[model samples]
Target chain A: MNVEQHHSTWVIILSFFISFILAIMPLPDWALSWRPDWVALVLIYWCIALPQRVGIATGWFVGIILDVLNDTLLGQHALAFSLIGYISVKIYRKMRLFPRWQQAIVVFALIASAKLLGVLIHSLFGSPEMNQPLFYPALTSLLLWPWLFIILRDMRRTYRVS
Target chain B: MISKEERKLVLRLIVFLFASIALMLTDHNSDYLKTVRAQLLGGVYPIQYLVNWPVKAGQSLSKNLNSHFQLLGENANLRDDNLRLQVKLQKFEDIKNENQRLRRLLGASEKLGERVEVAEVLAVNINQSRRKILINKGLSDGVFTHQPVIDAQGVIGQVIEVGIFSSIVMLITDPEHELPVQVVRTGLRTVAKGMGTVNRLSLLYLSNTELNTSIKVGDLIVTSGAGQKFPKGYLVATVIQVNPDIGKPYAQGQAQPRSALERNWEVLLVWQLEPSTVINDEFKTINSQ
Candidate 1:
């Protein structure tokens, strides 16, 4: 209802918007498997930073958008993303205390779990058989976490997102 | 966190989890959510276009960066190819006329009712696990589910999902796709299944005992118009490998798709000839009689 409040909310929405673009951007065949799960990574960052404001509801909605974007099942990503959001929200305090490298490790575990949930859901519908390539996106998300965390943190600070 | 707050969050999580699982089950088993997905896809279009904008700019910039010599060489080659194609077209027109006459003489019903419209590949799905590409054509362009798509080379795939302004195409190389094809040389029919890789399709359901000697490397496989999904005579793939053993149940073969499925930027959306054309053909055949 507040004009200023709506403007600041744009910051969070914009971050998710950019993440969606990166998630769908066409990559050359050689680099495709290693593409980071941009939506999941951004969802994790927001859940950790503003747990109450950007937790399960945000993840679930963004995930529905992702499901449509990927043209997979309507709720395939919604389910995974809500789970990611809940986990991050519950563990936000501990994650904030950890150093950046330690945070990266947590990021790896969270994303790996999310991807595992994805594979589980995929198997239910008989798509995307579990293979070595399934591991690469999570690994790439882990490798990108340090830089992404700082960048998003700076954006949140600059925009005073919370 | 307060116990009440924690309980609320956990409760919300369960709700979301169950809701999504139900959504997936229904979406997979039926088309109940097609309109919802189409509307959602419309909302997602801005992001797809935003991601494509820079890539399109880069491509246009690179196009102008070609040297004069290269342009001249390309022009000369194109001219030569156009001439050659025109000669082939002349033969094709005559052949079509002769075939139509033969069909009339035999009192056969009309065939050859396919049309094509051009579309550009807008974005490839970032999820490499699946072989889906988004094309610029959609419901607005009369694109529909199961419509055949092709490139200059041969059959590429078919449209799977149609949004308001764009559609998603599942390439034939996807593990989920199967095309019914007939061998040009031997008339042996079989279904080709995608092996979840680019440029390869595996022949399925060919009886090894009878089809073993017919399939060979370099043989051409094409649509047989079995299920009316694709029209007959579209080149689907060329046989690259064949191994038939009495020990195995079906004759085994691999095919190299004729289209550059992953690389082509432009494709043709094939449409069955309109009913008016059928009427015209019928009139022409009656006049011949």
Candidate 2:
């Protein structure tokens, strides 16, 4: 498959927007409590898939929007997202060589790190504390990574768009 | 060969970090972020409405189906109950009229004012840490900032942001929330603060010695109006657990919120009442001292 470089940017943006919509979608009460951070998951996937064009800067911008959208402390999600994006980009070449299952485990660790960083940043702002539910979404995101990767990978291949 | 764009990228990251620092400082120093929030939410609400439509419709369909069965069974039951209630209501109407006459004779203040508009909850913050919910009404529906929200059960929260078609409500269960309440049986006033856990709140700064006061496991707690921000007598919670230690200055207790705050699909926003402009002659005489 010939990968056209320019179209990959649009693919990334479109996927990110869909992730934002998913993140905001209302879920059933029990399900919502465990809903993954779809934006972060999508962003990380794109960073890994097309490392040359999408990087920390893109992640940071989306982070700011998510922070505003969720109304949390400024820079909480942005900083975490950018840092995670940077890490993924740094190892993208090696990651592309790994098996799908291995990549999913690595993505889980990255998402988990971002979640912890978010808590650390918010705590610096003196917001009231919460229990483990705040961290559960990250793990949930990791568990969804393999499926998301498979679906998105096929879309990129089929559309000839990517 | 590495391009100049690669070098520029490092500079851009530094710039973004610096910008974020400035934003953090500005958001901390003033209410400037509130305007940004309002504008962003206004723009995104249409998208939010689209995303929520399917879920809202599904919920409503299920609710309608469930109620339809009950409606048939309840039709005859409600008719009989309605007749009995009509008779009882006549007695209440007479008492209410007589009470109004006595209150006017004693120059008492009227408590219930104009009715309020009710709104339905459309969505909740996907991020659990923020603890915010969105309602279907916005500024067009007369919802303004800090308008108190209540359900049929009790106080829920207050409107914090208004969009064109929707408003964001900061729930009382949110970690940042604190409401002043009093024990109805003991008249002991204290501030109830959210623990960010469901169905629980802890009374802060109450003295241990006061634990002996008539406050009990089932004592009703209502807004004290001591802070005077919220109206008085709105149900807050019921004391569920109280523990006192001999040496501690305060007793620890928990409350089950009167409202099923986490599950309710609809809430009402209480509009603020204007204070009486007429000064009492008795108050004028006392102020001279």
Candidate 3:
């Protein structure tokens, strides 16, 4: 497999846009409250998959878009996502060496951190305090990570540089 | 090794962090971010509509099915239903005529108030912590910020956030939400606020000393019109619990709002009268006094 076969910047951008759509879909109230931060999760997967190319800048930009769409105070999500992306890039080599299950756990913690960061920022601005359903989405995303990785792994295998 | 490229990446991180901090500060504290918010939301609108396509389809399918059932009923059964409806209509018209005659005798306005536009609930954020719901109405649909929203049961919520195609409502059960309510049993008025408990709310600072009255369970509560946030006479809730203490000046009572607040299909957004006129009218009355 060659690096040239990997998805280009444009392809990643389009994929993120598609993932954003999935994130904002009007799921039922109960289901929506539990809907994992889909775009962030997807972005994290890609950032880990291709750390050299899509770095903190990509995360910050996409997070801004999410903030705007959700009508949140701007840059709140941007800061969280960018920080996670930076941390992921910094540890990409060590993270790659970890077992896949361990990697999923790391991703779970990182996503939870991003969500808590958002809650903290909102609360500081006098928004009413909300109980954090922190563990539910974290656990669900961790459980789903392996299947998501497998599907994307197959895509990478199919599009290898011959 | 801290290579030059790595240094550049670190520099990028610092720059972005600062930029994000600046943006967040401006967004939360200043009025300048609306232009940016508008532009970003405009860019995202196309994608939002595309994502919302399935929701619209599901709604249409349900509506079509309902109409189909109405169309497929037996003709004889329909005829009998029409006759029954006609008889009821005649009685309703008679009552309406009597009401109008009585209103004229009293020199009352024929129209009670402003008309309402019906809207559908498109999405709801049930984050128990931040209780907000979004409906498929916008400025284009004449929905403004702070408009009172009610369902067939009663006052469901109020519009707190508005966008181009949809508006978000903060429900009465939301922790930050409060409504001025009057006890129908005794005409005592107090502010009712969400207590962060589902199906429960508390009336704040109700002094039991002023009026030696006992409030029982199942007593009705209506809007007090004290703060002018909600119109007078709208049903707010019913007293579910009354805990009175002999020593305390105020009693802690709980009421369950008339609206389900959690689950409802349709809601009506009430357009309030313009505030400037209300303020000017108040000024005139104060000057005369």
Candidate 4:
């Protein structure tokens, strides 16, 4: 059991590292606003699948890293991710029981909340006007959730990662 | 045990939320975290490079896949462009000599040659209103904050933050950006404010009276160099619209930026000239004379 848990730790870190790459990957000008929130989606999946191991602290750490990556106001993503992490942990058990499509809806809500929180933080820093297209990433995140879920699940099971 | 775990989670969330707010407040209010940000960027730099590798590879792959005929055509076109530029270079040399002679007569200090370094654009801000781009050059490459960034056409932006191997450039079209500009035709000075649109910039501080007499559509606008951050006399934009407000004291005019902010793959970072020291030296020379 100890060995299994230790191996699963590598899996979690590796998943997050890939998500970080996806988060910063360059998209074409037109598709930039529509690019999915890769980090948030990955954190949500981990929070649901391995609630005890990954939770609010992990979210905060990842958020800080993302804040540095995006070059935005520091801590803006941290605040949003912490809140999303809390919500995910709070509902992880119920979320695990839902159908894949229904889970996608939950993912949408979670990611949207993070997006809204980010906009609110940005506005507080004197940029009050929000762009309409900023919400497109949430939609893409929702659509990508099922595929992400399946892949992460397959990796976890194949590796016997708890 | 489960209840204890839930309580711990709640406690952790509160702690993180508080820390985040504190960090945001400090980061926005001052430069205390600039070094910290730079250090953090060093860690992220490798990941960014890796993330961008595939795109670079694909671009080279496509270029390599081009037929011999296509390469020959491109090479011929480049040769033609080089010949045309050579002809233009002769005229520029003559102008340079004439300008130096005129400056000597006026006792004005000669303008120093600007040091320029080319950097490739790594990524653009995903957020629509921010209008920033990340470039591959940074402090290690002698890039500093407030260095003017330009493309083949004109001024694109300025470097706002420099990491170890990367930097962030805030484009002139960002909503938060404004630059001092002058009309090349009339020499009318004004401030051009970004209108959150890539194609347009708005000229501000123009009185309704001056707008009528001094400004005209199609007038070329260039940097005034008042702020000492951007050098004087780079093509910035051209006036496209003049709107007179009946009630307001100031008339509104929009100009199109000359730089291809969206399309350029590479940009030039120009070191700033010390305007104050130059002015002081010129004054000393005049007083001695």
Candidate 5:
């Protein structure tokens, strides 16, 4: 297989930039707990779409940026995103063959597990018992996956980004 | 079966995970990561500004399109408020001078006022669990960490992170915060802790003896100035509930914060007069007396 090395790296970087914005955007109090994990969703899409170019390292760095952005414990999101990136990369081929709805379920599991990892570490650090909204973002992310996939797919094709 | 690349991937993940946990541990247990966070905050400043652009645009647009009648009413209200404030300012001048003279006579430090700067809240709900807000003022504006924040009503929070153009204020309602507050009526000094929610603070370790007797519902709480963490006598909260412990040493009570913690837009950052300057003022007042 001939690999196309001419990836529009800026387009990929731009998508991640927008994801970072959404992650930090201010939300109303009612919606605060339900704000979807934008960075995680975008990273997962890139890992699966261009597994060769984006993977564990991309996810890890993005997580660090998010930790700084949200002022959370350092490396909390890093560890979670890295694991999800690895999983997505490993299953990218098989995931592409699955139906869209089936794909959403797997995405939910990936993001939810990552969020669970975050909750665990925070609990270790003595954060209060905030378990109810633990899966809200994951649920929101699951609902968003279908639309996001199409939007990002169009972006990828339009810019011919790997 | 794991292939060669897969093994490499697994090894990389393990190494990264180990490194991050180490980072988290260090950050949790010490202040070493603060410098790193401060440095990275400059890079993030632009991103935050970009996200706030639409909100700022909307505000300016509304201001520009205000109806003539609405503007006339707003101007009248402002003029009315200005006249009332001017009358109060004249009396305030006399009281400040009298207070300074009394403080000099008592040999206490003059602590009447602190210089303050007003900042707009740029963002809120930075994290769901931690109660924090980002303000438009930051390191460039000489904002230091741990500086107290307040509004027209009362205490809001303190600066936790200072970036190039923005700073994060941790509200008193955050689970990690503990404010030393004094009961206005009984002079009972106790620690008011965050209940992990807005408008509510838990006064911890209140003696059972004072419960239901001196510390009751509707009592006012203010900063005790303990540990010099916060300025003295600022309104903090008001007791909303007092549940006494019959046999225990302490009673559990709740207070509502005087400030609108969750709805703040414009906040004041206090510039506490340093002890050295305060001492100098004490000497100057003494010499004059």
Candidate 6:
């Protein structure tokens, strides 16, 4: 039991690390705005799978690291991710009972809210007008959810992460 | 009744949200957290470098795959370009000496040649509204905030934030950026404002009331060195379009920046010739004379 717990901890950390790398990878100019929120999606998955262990605090920490990497206003991603974390943890039980497609829709709504929060923070800081296309990332994240969910779920079961 | 676990979750969320707001407020309002931000960015530097490694490897791999004939052609073209530049340098050397002699006769200080350090581009901001790029050089490399950055073609931008091992450059095409420029043909001074377009800059403060404002399409614009932030006479942009708005006090003009702002892999960070105060005093002396 002790060995399993230790392995699961490493697995969770390794997953977050990979997500961070994906989040910072350079994208072509035309596809930049369409880049998915890899960190957020991963954080949501962990929050759902390990609600007791991963929650708002983990999200806040990861979000702050992302802000540092992106060189954006501090706490902007932190706030958004924390909100996503809270919502996911709140609904994780009911969400797990739903079909995979329904769960993906929930992920869509969660990520969309996070994007909205980011836009709100940017506007509040008096950033120049961003076009409506800023929401492209949320759409891409939604499309990627099902595949990511299946992969992560299999990994969890195979490793007995809980 | 709400469960204890739910209540604790709500409480934790509130706490984190409040902390986030507090952090955002402090970051936006002042420079108090600049040190913290810089140190945190230092931690992120290694990860960013690792993430960028694959792209760099791919670029080199493609270069190595080029045919020998193509390599020979490229080498020959580079050699020809070098010879042409050396011929131009000879003329510049003579002109520079004459200019220095004239300045000495006028009791004016000689303008020193700028010292530059090279830095490699690491990442670019994905946001279209914020035209920024991150480079590998930072405070440890003698880079400082507001240092002018240029590529071989022309001025690209200025360093805005310096981390321990990386820095952010705000490109000339950012909407918030403005630089003083002078027309090469007519010597008319004007402020060039970034138009959020890579190739174009807008000339501001040009009053239509000024009769025969010599600015026209295809006029060359260079730095005026007004703020002493940019060295004097660097190629900035060229006027592409000029339209006098009917009944308006100001005319609108657009210019294409000389720098290939978005494409360069390496740039030079230039240390300004003189401090702002010293430059201001020199300007005053020149004007009084």
What's chain A's TM-score in each predicted model? 0.94, 0.88, 0.87, 0.95, 0.93, 0.94
Residue B55 CA displacement from its true place in model 1, Å: 1.8
Write model 5 residue lDDT over A95-139, tens digit each, in one string: 999988888899999999998888789789987755457788999
Number of clashing residue pairs, candidate 2: 0
Model 1 scores a C-alpha lDDT of 0.86
Model 2: residues with Cα > 4 Å off, grouped in runs: A1-13, A26-34, A133-138, B1-3, B63-69, B75-114, B276-289
Model 6, CA-based lDDT: 0.85
Winner on lDDT (2 vs 6): 6
lDDT of 4: 0.85
Q: What fraction of native interface contacts is shared by candidate 5?
A: 0.70
Which 10 consecutive positions of candidate 5 chain B have the poorest summed lDDT? Answer: B106-115
Q: How big is the positional error of residue B282 in model 5, measured in Å on the Cα after superposition? A: 10
Better of 2 and 5 by DockQ: 5
DockQ of each: 0.73, 0.45, 0.51, 0.63, 0.69, 0.63
Q: Judging by lDDT against the true structure, name the best candidate.
A: 5
Reproduced native contacts, each prediction = 0.81, 0.42, 0.60, 0.64, 0.70, 0.64
Which of candidates 1 and 4 reaches a greater DockQ?
A: 1
Clashing pairs in 5: none
lDDT (Cα atoms) of all candidates against the true structure? 0.86, 0.76, 0.75, 0.85, 0.87, 0.85
Instruction: Compose the digit string of candidate 1's lDDT tens values, residues A41-77.
Output: 9999999999979999899999999988888788988
Model 1: CA > 4 A from native = A128-130, B104-107, B274-276, B281-289
| Candidates ranked by TM-score | 1, 5, 6, 4, 2, 3
lDDT of 3 by residue, B1-289 (tens): 7999789879999999998989988877877876556456546766676776777788789767776557667566889999999999999867865775677689765333334778877543323355666677776687776788987677887886666667768888878899988888888878889876667788887776633574667889888777766777788889888776669888888899888776765788886655345446547967999
Q: Candidate 1 chain B: minimum summed lDDT over ten consecutive residues — where? A: B123-132
List, residue by residue over B1-289, the lDDT tens digit for candidate 4. 5798788888899999999999999999999999888888877887888887887788889999999999999999999999999999999968865775677688776354466889998753434556788899987998888889998789999988889999888889888889999999889999999878777798998888887689999999999989878888999998999888879988899999999987777999997545355556658977999
* CA shift of B182, model 1, Å: 0.7
Q: Give the CA lDDT, 0 to 100, for residue B216 in model 4.
A: 92
- lDDT rank, highest first? 5, 1, 4, 6, 2, 3
Residue B109 of model 1 has an lDDT of: 73
